[model samples]
Structures are given as structure tokens and as C-alpha cells.
Target: MSEHNTHIEEHRDDEASKLGMWLFIFTELLLFGGLFLVYSIFRLQYPANFHESSLELSVTIGVINTIALLFSSMTIAFAVTAVQKKNNKLALRMIGITLLMALVFLVNKYFEWGHKFEHGLYPGSDLMQLLERGHHLYFSLYFFMTGLHALHIIVGMILLIIVYFKVKNGSIHHEKYVFMENGALYWHLVDLIWIFLFPLLYLIS
Candidate 1:
């Protein structure tokens, strides 16, 4: 009877954990949704300038980052499945791949940002100060939105690392992987946001 009660309590806790994660994700969505609405309003207000500014972005780097995040999403999903299947080694390998892809994405972003910095295209540079109103607004939104997404990427990576170590130590395994599941959900959210960002910030040109 005690063992059965413990099982019931564990299930409840897992359910509660999942619900909490969903709530957090919902809040994140609301935040980004607001940002997206603002972006759309400005994009409509300065269509030509938005297009011109977006042309300055390297589509090659944007596509590469997109692919990296997509691949990472796949690997993380695989990791979750591996854990559920009780294949700890496979789970670890998948998580490693996911982390590597995330690193690739961030590294590419670093170089891309550096390139913009070299050209004095960032938010506070004299070049930006001299730009037209539309151009200035475009760059501002570009930096703010992508920078915010990059922050989320770092947070997602931290969550994945925690999940990795937990899985390694057997704290998150087949029978109890709520943490891993939640981490993957967060990672996917990161990727999804980038999906929206890529076209809006890069391909619109």
C-alpha cells in the first residue's frame, strides 16, 4: 500500500512538473509574441528600409544557423527517446550532438555579429546614428530581437547541460525523465522562435 501511494505521488509530481513547464513556455511565447507584433508594425511602417537593412544580413550565416538549430532539435528529440527507451549511452551521444549543433549556431552568430560590428552597423555606432529613421529602426529591432534570441539559446544550452548531467548520473532515466522532457521542450521552443526569426530578419530581403 505504501509503495502504491508513493507511485501515485511520483506521478502527480511529474504531472505538476510538466504543467509548470508548459506555463513557463506560455509566458515566453507571450513575451516573444509581443516583440513580433512590434516588429511587424515597424516592418510595415518601413518596408523598404527593412528590406534594405535585412539585405545587409548574411543569408549564408542565417541559413547555417537555422540548419544547426533544426538539427539540434532533432538530436534533442532523439535524446529524449533514447532515455525513454532506457538506452543511456545513446541518450548521452544524442545530447552531445545536440550540444555540438548549438555551439555551431552560436559560433556562426558570433562571426556574423563581428562582421556587422566591423562595419559599424550595430545599435550605437556612429554609422547607425547617421542612418535614416527607418534604417535606424530596422537595425535596432534586428539587434534587439536576435540578441534576445541568443540569450534564450544560452539558457537552453544550460538546461540541456543540466539534463545531460542528470541523465549521466541516472537521476533522469527511463522511468523518471521529467527533467529531460522539460529541457527538450524548452530547447524546441528556442528553435521554433528562430524559425520565425530567420525569415523575418534574414529572408525578408
Candidate 2:
């Protein structure tokens, strides 16, 4: 092989990698899109139930979590920018802050779920047995969708942690920061999903 061909083989395409991440993100959107469609149909079937069920949800906590996730999304974006600017320390700090925000989100979710359980609102509970079909379905969907989103948040947090250490070790730097970009993209998707979820589950009226 020619020396030029060998050199080209050694370097990867960052734009191509980003395109791959975008494609993956689309698949995720489609998956959630189906769930949202189902939720909409059910709401139409039981308009009053959905509205009342949404009222049971703590709007104050939901709004707080929304703000936290949105802020974390910005932090991760800034971290990626710092990497592009060759400021690895700032990138690490940004990632740290983003991770803390994720922790806060999870803590809030724990308490929120706990409160529901205390009220016997979880799936298959005695209270669930007493509720009408529409009311029962509301709590069921609420648990299923939010549970999946929290799982995504956990995955995003793990990705951010890995990227933070990689940046600290100089593996992800200005000229080669595609991994950081991918991590940021995933985090943004997590936040975006929650943006849709908050209103769907909390403000249905």
C-alpha cells in the first residue's frame, strides 16, 4: 500500500461518526413516538380521567425536574465546546456539573415515585383495583413511560462519566472530540424526551 493510503487509514472521520449518532437518535425518537401516539389515543378515549390523573401529579416537582434537566443539557453542550477549544479542564468541570444535575433529577424521581406508592397508586396495587378503567390506565402509562425515561437518564449519566475521564486523559481533545459530541447528543436526547413527557403527563387538561 502507498504511504498516503496508510496515513488515511490511521485517521477516522469525525463527521461520519456524528452522522451515525444522529441516526441512532432518530431510532430512539421513533420508539418514543409510538408510545406518545398511544398515550394520545387513550387520552381521547378518557378525557376526563386523563385530566384528573394529571392533576394528581405534582406540577411543582415536575417543573423543577424539567428545569434541572434543561440546565444539564446546556452544561453538556458547553462541555463539548470546551473540548473543541482545547480546554480539557473546563470540559471536565462541566461534565461534573452535568452529572450532579442528573443526580438531582434521580433524587426527585425517587421521592415522586415513593409518594405515589404511599397512595397505593402503583400498578396492581389495591387502589389501582378500585379505580375505573381510564384512571387505571393513566397510572399504568405514567409508570411505564417515566420508568423508561429514567433508565435513559441513567445510561446518559454513565456515558458522560466515561467521556469526562476520557477528556481528562487526553483521549478526547480538540482535533478528535467526536466521542464527546456523541455523549452530548445522547444527553440532549434525554432532556428532549423529558420536555415532551412533562407536559404530556402533568398538564393534560
Residue ranges of candidate 2 with Cα displaced over 4 Å:
1-9
TM-score of each: 0.94, 0.94
Kindly provide the TM-score of model 1 when superposed on the true structure, using C-alpha atoms.
0.94
Model 2, residue 194: distance off in Å is: 1.0
RMSD per candidate (Å) reads 2.5, 2.6
lDDT tens string, model 2, 98-158? 9999999999999999999998889899999999988998999999999999999999999
Report lDDT (CA) for all predictions: 0.92, 0.93
Candidate 2, lDDT over the whole model = 0.93
Candidate 2: lDDT of 30?
96
Report residue 144 deviation for candidate 2 (angstroms): 0.8
Residue 48 CA displacement from its true place in model 2, Å: 0.5
Residue 74 lDDT, candidate 2, scale 0-100: 96
Task: Output the number of the lDDT-best candidate.
Answer: 2
